[model samples]
Target: MLADIRSRLGGVAGINFGIGGPIAHRIDHLLSGARAGIAIKFSGENLRTLRDLAEEAQTRIAGIPGVTDVAVESQSEVPELGVHLDRERLARNGVSFAEAGLTLRAALYGAPVSRVYEGRNAYDLVLRVQEVAPDSIAMLERLPLRTDTGALAPLSAVATVTRESGPNIISRDQVQRKIFVTCNPAGRDVASVLADIRDAIDPLLEGKVGYAVHYGGQFESAAAASRRLLASGLLILLVIFGLLCMTFRNARDATFVMASLPLALIGGVAAVFLSGGVLSIASIIGFISVFGVAARNGIMLINHIRHLQSEEGVAGFEEAVWRGSVERVVPVLMTALTTGLALVPLVIAHDAPGNEIQSPMAVVIIGGLLSATVLNMVVVPALYLRFGRPVKNNGGAAGTPGETFL
Candidate 1:
């Protein structure tokens, strides 16, 4: 039924169906996201070429997997009436083109020459040409126009009427002509679908100059968010490094804490994959959050070892590492368990409506903590033992804040 309406309306109308809830839609828009799963925008100077490209793209895009509801924006030429005025004839009759145009406008459109006020309302009083002849090509030709000589002459003497076709609307982007090839994706991740689209179209458009392709709608927002998140992630890593160095008072220890991030992320990624969740902005945020937790765990265990060596005078490196790991077992388990339990609802109900943004994050966090807690226990201690060599100075066993275990 909707397709029928669109076909009936032809090139004169456009429609877009919004997907997802109001909040999600707003976020998508703010991120410059796609309305459809796949949207390809072709921009160039020639409308005819752009139209052909859009049509060809529409056909090709529909062939790709998971693509459906493929539609190209309307660029079909619409039938129009063209009027050509003969300047010589109008000059010979001492009639200006403006005069003829005004007369024709009044005849065709019923010119509002006056207004009548009644109570609080004002009504337009219009005057129009009478239907003097049956509809025919000769009707407009036979219409009379008054000349400067106060004589009526047929308008056919001064003008010619012909039928032509033109685009119903011309769309421009950044002063260049643009046409859209839109498609919806089902049963696939947007990133995968977009990759396929690019792979399919890139070769065709590669050497073409002054013509460009852009992905719009949801892809737009996704790309923008990805770029922003990447930059933010870099800055976050820097901040984390700075804070760790400040707290540990040593570059090696700080670097060790940072190293655990990848180990923790591995489990998070695995969890998302096992849960059949796509990597989205929410997942990225979850990974970033998990990094902080992983670093915190490393700090807790390492700091505890240093405290034990300084206060209790533990002599062996292996022993100090073992005691530290055992002491932190309860705290680490409780922290990870509490966080995972809190997010259990989100993880379990990931597919529930309105949970699209939260589920991926919960899954990542829960999985990351599980791995990070375990790895921080074993791997961080091993790394600490290997690199955290004790420095002695000044004739006594003077340690750089427990740098020397003995």
Candidate 2:
């Protein structure tokens, strides 16, 4: 039912709207942050300003299409202070840190001096030098300090009142102060939504402030992994082809085996489309399984053809190819079917919804195997028959005494 809706509504292209491009995060970093270098000041004031910006940014992000749950951090703060003590001036005025602190506390919040007890209730008439407690900077500065020589000095004489930022909890990565906002895409692929989020953010954040905003979520990790996976798969294919050539002593057999890969992938990609799914972790895993299984099926068919040509003294190449494919067909089909059946549970039962997971992998493998099984029978044999011409051997080193060559 869901598949039908997507089919009518623009197919996978509309779905691609949610996939993100690779360079989104790097671009985001360059725009929002001052520099990638070490920042000496990740102070409370700096972060508070960042949080305010983030809050505004978060609001803007929430309004964009396909975005949900926008949240940010970096809001560290100190108590709203009216600090009077200046460390430099205190030393010049003959005041120690503790001494200045004690005087300031006494003047601001005068201590209890007297208590009167009654039978039913205890009442205390405390005497404090200052009637109204000094809560404001102006009042606190008026606090009188008795110097060591019996001289009364205003706290203003020793300290300068200033409001400054402070630091609390700090977050870092690679020993560099780091901060980021997290968000979920609403019913969309992480990659596509990430792209949309970046586009919405770029204009608003071009000249925001000192800090930079980066998108670091599961999507980024998966996309990176996907690129690695592609490279790994290609590397595996090249290695396999090289190994096959060495084993068969002929590039012809190796080419036959490698040709099976394209058909195998066709089924995998088709399965993803059929299931109304994205190119997800599970799909990639399925691709891996498909490649391995398809390659194995091709190898089996190729090995059998090579075996028949050398061992059975098969004179005709087409006959050898036909006999080899016929022998391997049942086993290949059975292998493909058994594996496809094994993946049924994953395709049917989704442990976590909204994201294509192991189920898509199962789907891809099943579909790829379905296509590979048929192609392995026809494709591998055709390539072998075309190239496996009975090369004239002069009963010499070209055809080794007991060595089999395809």
Candidate 3:
């Protein structure tokens, strides 16, 4: 669709196209707003030089594959009608500068002379010369101006009227003039596209004094988000570990429980690979949720085994492990099944409205649950039997010694 639109608009000049995405995607961007595409900002004192550099950068970026809608954000030049005043000519003609300016303004854009009133309405009645084209230099030069001597003189006697080109709009950042060369990436990621853009424009910017180039837009936002997510993930893991240690009252048990996180991630990663293989923000969030669920399952099984020995008067450590695993099977299966079934719809309708982000997330969660549920039941039991410590009841009932769960 984008290619067809570009082809149709090929003949039109100075046009920029913005490609929109799903409604949910647009709403997400609106709520957490950021500029789209790659924006390279060039800042310098000289507008002409800055404009030239921006155009050159734009041309270089346009050659790169997957780049589209390449354009300079600021238009450097636009047609303008200029009236250059001659002070000497004005004094000789006894016409003040203000008088000549007023004459030209009145002829081009009429001034309000009086107000016309109806029963309940009032409108300005403007008076000025008619049948004169404001864009015609000849008509402007022939405009009559009042002189101090009570006589009329041609505007040409005090000023020269000509058409010229000047900057239409000037953009500034941090009190310095700047121009942006922006483009949208089609089939490539923002980082790779921006890297190619940097490589293409590096040579052109070498030794360019008093000028600086900065990259922004989607690339900037993505990079920042990646850093933040990394930090948050690490912090969350630490917090989860701390809570586990507090709950189990031993670091060994907590570490064992944390092992379920990696098990859960194995399925999550596989699911992402199966579903378009894109590790988006939604996928990361899914992984976080999966970690919590995996840890909770481990905690439930381990705590139940300890409870059977310490509180239920179980005879032996091996018996406690067996009975605990068998008893908790139903609860664990129910938890995993309910959550996975609920997310099945989202996973199937991945491309449906408002499901773009949630679908990938659902896939991760469902996959993680399948792996964590099976492994938590089997692996946690084997590991506990081999290494988990024996528990003693407050009532003086004790299990076999030298047995370690951690």
Candidate 4:
């Protein structure tokens, strides 16, 4: 559909297509600080570089694969009629620039002299020139201007009115003049497309003084939120580690349980790759959740083995490991299956509106559970058997002659 529209509007200059409605655009602006799929910003004092660099960046971005509808933001050019006053001319005609400007404002632009109230609504009573105001320089040259001595003179005698183009609005960020090159992403992730855009433009813009480039739009929030979440994840891990140490009373036991985390990650990473290689906030949250569940399973397995050795009188390391693993197999599989199955519908409905956020999370959790449960049943027990020791009785080594160590 987009391709058809593009084809239909071929050769139309300065026209760029955009996706979504007003609300979506506003959301994009809120997320990215740019109201498009991508925003490449340029800043400088030179208007030429602002215009040239923005255009150049837009063109290069469009050339990159998966970039579409690239264009420099419009509304920067404004058609204005400038009245440049000549001081010598004004003095000779006994006219001041202020007086001439007031005359122009009152006559041509309809200055509001007073207001009239009709009930609750008030209307401006304007004063304007009756004769058709000049639309061209020739006509404006002949327009009358009031002088200080209460005389009238041709506006051309005191000033020059010329048609020119200027910015309707000047926008600044961090006290620097800025222009935005807006574009949409097609057939690719926003992050990859942004990288490509930067790659293509950075070298060309390198070594230029007083000019800088900024990227804005959805990726802005994505990058920031990802950074914060990563930090939070680290903190969560530290807290989890501390809690595990308290629970087990042995650093080695805690470390062995945490070791199973990598096993869980294998499936989660595979799921992300298989579903869509996008790592969103939802996906990160899912990984965090995965850590908790994976840790629980590891703790459950290790604790059961300890119980068998200390309470159930399981004789050998291999026998205790096998018995504990077999005892917990049903419970571990049940827990993992129930959680994964509950998210199956979301995983299937990948294209639903809100599912964009939920689906990745579901996929990650489900995949992590599958691998974590299997590894908990197999690898975790092996780790425990290798590292764990049975509780000592009054006699050391269970059957040796009475001996104790401090």
Clashing pairs for model 3 are: 387-404, 387-405, 388-404, 388-405, 388-406, 389-404, 389-405
Rank the candidate models, highest TM-score first: 4, 1, 3, 2
Candidate 3 Cα deviation (angstroms), residue 342: 2.6
Show pairs that collide, candidate 2. Answer: 18-192, 19-191, 19-192, 20-191, 20-192, 32-212, 33-212
**lDDT of candidate 2 over 1-406, digit per residue (tens):** 4335434543443121112334644443344332211111222225556555556666776677756434454445664445657777766766677877776665556656677788888776655557534336676677677766667777788887655555566666555555556554546666777677667666655665545655555665577789999899889888998998887677776788888988898888888888765788778878887888888888898877667666666667778778889999889988988898888877778655643467777888989998888877887777777765553333332332334554
Per-residue lDDT tens digits of candidate 3, residues 157-235?
Answer: 8888889887888878899999877677876656677789989988887889999988776656556677898899999
- Of 1 and 3, the candidate ahead on lDDT is 3
Candidate 1 regions exceeding 4 Å error are 1-37, 42-53, 73-79, 85-103, 110-136, 143-155, 164-179, 199-213, 272-277, 341-350, 389-406
Report the poorest 10 consecutive residues by lDDT, candidate 4: 397-406
Please, what is the whole-model Cα lDDT of each candidate in the order they appear? 0.77, 0.67, 0.81, 0.80
- Per residue, candidate 4 scores C-alpha lDDT tens digits across 284-338 of 8999898889998888887777677666677787888898899988888888988
Error of 4 at 150 (Å): 7.8
Poorest 10 consecutive residues by lDDT, candidate 1: 390-399
TM-score of 3: 0.68
lDDT of 1 at 135: 31
Instruction: Quote each prediction's TM-score.
Output: 0.73, 0.65, 0.68, 0.77
**Which of candidates 1 and 4 is the stronger one according to lDDT?**
4
TM-score of 1: 0.73
How many residue pairs clash in all the candidates, one count each? 7, 7, 7, 1
What stretches of model 3 exceed 4 Å from their correct place? Answer: 1-7, 21-35, 63-65, 74-76, 79-164, 396-406
